[model samples]
Target: MLSQKAKYALQALLALAELDEGDSLMIGDIAEKQRLPKRFLEQILLDLKHQGVVQSWRGKNGGYALLKSADKITFGEIVRIIDGPLAPLPCLSRMAYRKCDDCVDEERCAVRRVFASVHDATTEILDSMTLTRALNGGEVRELLRGTG
Candidate 1:
């Protein structure tokens, strides 16, 4: 399941993608438009900025904007940034793998195998998806079809 913070981050990015390039969106405007809390968004945006995913400006027109084009950012990347690894189990995580404490033999672990499959498929879908495609109403099936 996606965390509330990750969902809010995606919403904020998608909202920013809707605007023209070089346009900055105020945190308050994003909160009202995306129906997220102002304080919460401030923290999320700060984290994103720290990750270099978004840039911030100060003053009357100051707010936040994507550091680059939407197509350059993947849902998987942001999800991992906000929610950590996408693997269902630690053993299945490519970036943060750890053997199951109770497992006798990872090679014979059926549970790991099943979860590995799930992790692979999930990663494939999420990694391939960009905010650009999503903002244009592209669906996962459509992205899989290479139409978006």
Candidate 2:
């Protein structure tokens, strides 16, 4: 499940994605435009900025903007940034892998095997679904078809 913070972050990013090149939007404007809480958005933007996903400008016209092209940013990247690993189990996480306490043999664990497939499929679609593809409709469906 997507956390509220992650959802808001994506919404804010999408709002920024709509801007013309070299243009930026203030935090308040982004929050208002996306109907997000201003205070929470402030922190979210800061986190994103730290992750190099966005850059902040200072001054009268200063705001936030994507550090790279939208097509270079994937949902999986942003989600992992804001929400950590997407794996259903710690053992399945590549970045934060840990042995499950109850597991006797991971290779033979039925639950792990089933969820590994789920994790693989989920990550495949997410890693492929870039912000540009998301903004352009039908790309997700096409990605889904390709994955299957």
Candidate 3:
């Protein structure tokens, strides 16, 4: 599952995508359209601005818009920004790897091997899917690992 942060980010991005040229959405507007709370949407948009996924203009018409075209930005990248890591195990993670304590051998663990493949496959699909594609209701499956 996407974290609350990631879900909100996706929602906000979709809302921004709905705007016309040079048109920006206010926090309240995005929250209302996305059914998110204003305070939470504000923080999420701020973080997205920091990440350069979106930008904000400071004024009455100010809110946020994509720094780049939506199609150029992949879902995997956005998820990494908000969710930290997509991999189920830290050891299998590319961006956020940390050693697992219970594994007797990092190089030879069957559990790690299976999940590592899953992570790679998931990333492959997500890396190809863009924010616009998702906003358009693209048919990407949620590649959530574990926690059945």
Report the C-alpha displacement of residue 121, candidate 2, in angstroms.
Answer: 0.8
Q: Estimate each model's TM-score.
A: 0.95, 0.95, 0.87
Off by over 4 Å in 1: 145-148
User: What local distance difference test score does each model get?
Assistant: 0.91, 0.92, 0.81
- Candidates arranged by lDDT, highest first: 2, 1, 3
Best by lDDT: 2
lDDT of 1 by residue, 1-148 (tens): 9999999999999988887888899999999999999999999999999998999899998888999889888999999999999999988887899988899999999998988888887898899888998887778886667665
Model 1 lowest lDDT segment of ten: 139-148
- For 72-126, candidate 3 gives per-residue lDDT tens digits of 8887888888888899898987666789988789988999989888888888778
Query: Which 10-residue window in model 3 sums to the lowest lDDT?
Result: 139-148
Model 3 scores a C-alpha lDDT of 0.81
**Cα deviation in Å at residue 121, candidate 1?**
0.9
Which residue pairs of candidate 2 clash?
A: none
Tens digits of per-residue lDDT for model 2, 25-83: 99999988999999999999999999999999999999999999998898999999999
